[model samples]
Target chain A: MPCQILPPYLLEKIAACERPEMAHAATAARRSLVHDAPLRRLGDRSLATDQPSPVPRIADPAMPVESGPAPTVDRTVSDAEGSENLPGKIVRTEGGPVTADSAVTEAYDGLGDTWRLYWEAYGRNSVDGRGLPLDATVHYGQDYDNAFWNGRRMVFGDGDGQLFNRFTISPSVVGHELTHGVTQYTANLVYQGQSGALNESVSDVFGALVEQFARGQRANEASWLIGEGLFTAQVHGVALRSMKAPGTAYDDPVLGKDPQPADMAGFVTTDSDAGGVHLNSGIPNHAFYLAASTLGGYAWEAAGQIWYDTLTGGLAATSDFAAFAQATARAAEARFGGSSAEHAAVLGAWKTVGVLPG
Target chain B: MKVYVSRVGGVAGIRLTWQVRVDDQPDADSWWRLLEDLPWQSAPSGPVQPDRFCYEIKAEPHEAVIAENELDGPWRELVDRVQRADTDSR
Candidate 1:
């Protein structure tokens, strides 16, 4: 056997740091990359989940591809039945008739809509840019109040009736979860510090685009709010977070104020939530909103396309906000011309957010 | 005795916390038992999945950042009880 300097677990601890520039951490990440399927996942994954996660579905080339006029959207929905188990029982699949349970129908349609947004706008087939089947589980745990993409698939919770409703109620939330999977297959930005925030912002950007596309709304016409209908009437909030104006999404005695910062001046620094990935994401969220709204038409046409290109083109696992800003600027210039308003708008948005110089 | 739980992460990325004053409860011993059952010597450490809920639990130096799926038995009971307490997460 090859000499083992440190235990595999110790190597994992170093790999979890995921800072590619750090020689020790990078070597550890590279070593851990082949330790096991699950450990390799953490090499570029957003979450350092304790439990073993389900393996991502790889497209089987051995299985023949079905060519047709329209690409098939394969979605599978499951019912957890108030348990924490994922994909508990398959309740619905592609082309299945709507179920009596609203959660089931909503999840199915939401998954389809998210898949359609990626396909229709970017010509991306699915989360992996391959025909990876989409899977989602609903009614997970009793009165569970959050939704998530657990590396392999989406899991939805029925919100506590006191403060929130079913998670499937919002299209943006669904879009957001699915985009995490997209990020996993693309840039796979390390889910810590500024890079984690960029990973989050990328999801929010496409999440908003998915909602806007579904509604056929112009960039300026869109709500620009994520989780718009997730809150109960009792909660004093319009949405979970806002792209147009961050920190102003909600204010209530129960949930407190929205903690997002719209610009670098207000950027929050912390160790929680993977270095405040969700909190600092507001900075880029607002930037995309500004660029899309300034363009005055469908966001997917220019602003969204630029962001999409930047994401798919990939970045270092440790790309910070400034690096992401420069990449988007280059993408905009390449697609829309260096002198075009699209390029100018992208640069101006980043400058306004303090990610780039004015 | 205060048992604190703050759930962060998920797609929403908001932090919601619950601080239970176990001393205030008549069944303080029961609460203590649950708190003691948790792994306090070292926080459960590992890589978390994207968009999964991460909980920060603290009863003073006894703190851990646990992913939602890892929560079981006492951890689950404490969180569920704290949540059902219906106190606002300030």
Candidate 2:
């Protein structure tokens, strides 16, 4: 699934508004809709037919073909240069000198940070957990206010600079997009309804974790905001989504309010956004935040480990919120004793989010 | 006749609508001919792929909702023209 960082509802809000300040946002939203519609259709066809994603897998030109225990971070960053074409021109590779383009440098560093987080924390390789060379394209389109993983590689857009900055400015944004590939290889969660929301939540979980791990921030110390720096001063938003407080992340005259519901009672019943995958993900995201905060230490150690385990530990592709909660509880108990604080915290967190019975 | 085309679905779940009066179109007869030839009445209804688009077409007394991939021939052309019209207006 090619999951985008910004949801369509926000774009629609901007497009429908008549505010003079939002004219650029409206144009950007319209252009993004037009460009993304066909690409999304193509992605759906591949998924429906079980054909490989239209995004071809490109091997790293820098890395040699060798089979060993070498934990190498093979990252290749390309420049789209304001065009929609992807993997445009290879601007920087792993071990290469930094380019003058800040987007390229930020993308390269972000990919490396994500790789280090997974490698050092979970011993997992790249996205596929098998040393799949990381590839990213920066400056993907003309003020295209979104970043996505097209099943094979990451693509970042230079934002309109009013409501959004460059997509690569936030490492969690990069992690969030790349983690879709992780979900693709792991549970391969069906990207619709409750299961789809779980898929989105899992990405957010690791995305925040990746940022936390890179910054050495404890759960309490972390901001718990995804895409923190991606938003400009004009947006009147802290970030794109807040794991700590999902619905409170953003509320602007142009972008409207973040529509994420933090609990089951608020679960949106919508026929769009893959059944509100981005909207309903707030429930589970809040759950993770509660668990991590309650555990009161480095999140990537215990809470992050449990979520990672549940994700890779034979979770069903169609697992709903309750099923996912139960899986995480079981994983916590398996990793820690049933009487351990980790298990109790995991169960308590789910209950707090109304996914599990208290 | 005024034709309204609205697209729903895709990753963001946003609905995009474009309205154009067919009578004002440069190729009004061709547009009507294409619209009439589409299999609008028989379009299936059920779960579609997460990112695939579903289009709702409305022209006064006639309306139909069709999935993007299922659309072919004249329906595709109608959609293309409507999208182009919307883009041009923007």
Candidate 3:
């Protein structure tokens, strides 16, 4: 387990404190990683087959009891019925409303749209490519500052609302969360070390692609940034992370600089949270950016197809960057041919990211 | 009070039952408000019978609080408010 995927230097940074309590917490968290690592290995082995989930059904009060094919639940139920009479989406919208509506509504809408797109675009339904209903929740904590797909439904925090506004509003943010579900369904990639980084990168690639496709933007025209519109104007530039240029996304003093490394040499290899999945995703993020740019058209059409095919076609749980590169190459060849331009583009992109064989 | 949640044809649904010690309970209205306030789109029609109601809440995309005791803050306030209304009518 190496006590976490973070470098000892970064772990030291997190442990920066003379206070005994703070130091003890960090030490304990690091120690806990030893146990978690082996369990993760077990998970990798278990993930080789389709994971079983408790299937959920819609329980609409208005509908009569009838059993046939389940009706596709209309997502815009709250909107369709008048707000005065109908039930509000998640939290109440009108009188005595305890939860904020905008964040929850945005998250809900984004999940629905992303689910629909995944279904409509590639004839794949829902997160699992089955007709699984997409699930999400917003306003998770008082000032929670991150959003994640926690092996199940999507959960979004309201954010500090200072550095980051509501996370649900960004299409890329929702896309990122949904991609985690997709990754869970298909690749079932183990979350640690280089493999974990690739997992994060895959989410970023799909995240940006969802945004690009939503906006009808070509790859060249795309900004290639993840969470581009998430930050308030006071912070600095556009986004929390950038796929096109890895570390250059944000350098503000408050949130700290984006620590993603663009090449294999700079790859982070600590063991916290599945080997710093968020940190090392930079390498794969940059690789996808290169692939999309090289393809020189809508990313969803070519690069997205290659990646999606690779993911759905029985991917190993512990596949690392090199393995992923080979898979993408194989997928591209299977999709476009061994000597095709798309295959060449895939190779070139992996090479650029230093994932390809020397 | 015993609440029953059953799954019928894969559709998980909620059924509510409450026992009252007092006849013609004055706090029933408050209970209705609480039931209506639950974060579910599929609830039964208004309040039902003397002290029973049925509703359904799907468990996905969001989770909701299903039960609360009268001693709890909001729930206590509701019972108090209802009791005061009954006293005034008498």
Candidate 4:
């Protein structure tokens, strides 16, 4: 704060000023330098940064340099013009005024919320943890039915509007796609079989967390819905998947029924969807819900930290449901102690979801 | 010959399948050419990205799995044509 009042140049001059009347000014300048020093060094990565960057957080005079990142929120939202072609036109950028296009504004704000959850809750810089700029494309296709992470950027479709609404309508869905980028950088889980399900589950876990963090909802108050508000009124569903009750999110004649399995017993064994990545993920999703809700506070605080640790704790890319359960268990113990309630909650949650031994 | 395309592994986790009886269509020659012109040599292989659709195509004797992200010009056209033909026949 003081850095803005006294420019670094002015502070330097004042620190060097030997006038007896300016002794306090020199002392204050030295303190500001220490307080404003960047806690984490940002690396040089050649990212597409055509938009305006965040207002630089100058070193404040009265604050200590905490262990959080310097907080870079570089976002770019483009439009596909109803075509499959990517990033058709730049419609919005970081810190820019809201656009008339609802999809573009929703995406920009959603990306910002996702970035905030990772940065504030876990102190992560971006998807790559290196302050990688986030880019998204909306209106990806005419009557398209899905959204996805293309290994580089998030792409959202204008849903057919018969069964689904626009993909950017729900913040959780945007968070879900962006978390795919997170999983790509962290565990890089093999996108097939149980490991693939874990990949999906991890995304859903943090996706819900992003929404919760933004809404300031406690664990109990949260919806635990992954794609809420994406379905139209005609679709008889509250969301695409419910962590609390996996297969109960939707059931409609046209859209069929939600096929997710809550625990291992009902887990669908199929060759579709990369060995049912979307189906089997309900197991871990429920596990996270139980752990977070059981702790009964901010879901992102204790439960989220454990999951974040396990994600970056270097599990194998081929980690299965059981291996992932073990990793989360160990992560909870490492942070909250084996005797602590947090570790117990994680183990209990996984056990309830049939991913761990009872 | 018959062609079947199934799209799977998207954010919604739903499978959508479309098929066409290549010989039954009035545009049979174009369908045949599109089916045969697939770039079989350059299949997608690398670290798999999350949530992108994986399309599985099954023809009379040939089958291929293509990632949506890697779906090139030919892949997109084949899918679009089959979807259109399937819708018309339905």
- lDDT of the candidates, in the order given: 0.80, 0.78, 0.59, 0.80
DockQ of every candidate: 0.54, 0.17, 0.01, 0.52
Where is model 1 chain A poorest over a 10-residue stretch in terms of lDDT?
A55-64
TM-score of 2: 0.73
How well is each residue in A35-117 modelled by candidate 3, as lDDT tens digits? 23334444554766663331222121222244455324123212211122123344522222334467656766676567644
Local error of candidate 2 at residue A290 (angstroms): 0.5
Best by DockQ: 1
Considering lDDT, where higher is better, how would the candidates rank from best to worst? 1, 4, 2, 3
lDDT of 1 at A108: 90
True contacts kept of each: 0.79, 0.15, 0.00, 0.79
Minimal lDDT window, size 10, model 2 chain A:
A55-64
**Regions of candidate 3 where Cα sits further than 4 Å from its true position:** A1-100, B1-90
lDDT winner, 3 or 4: 4
Across residues A218-282, which tens digit of lDDT does each residue of candidate 2 receive?
79999999888887898778887888988888787766777888888898998655677888999
For model 2, the stretches where C-alpha displacement exceeds 4 angstroms are A1-70, B1-90
Of models 2 and 3, which has the larger DockQ?
2
What local lDDT does model 1 show for residue A176? 90
Stronger candidate by lDDT (2 vs 4): 4
List of clashing residue pairs for candidate 2: A8-B12, A273-B13
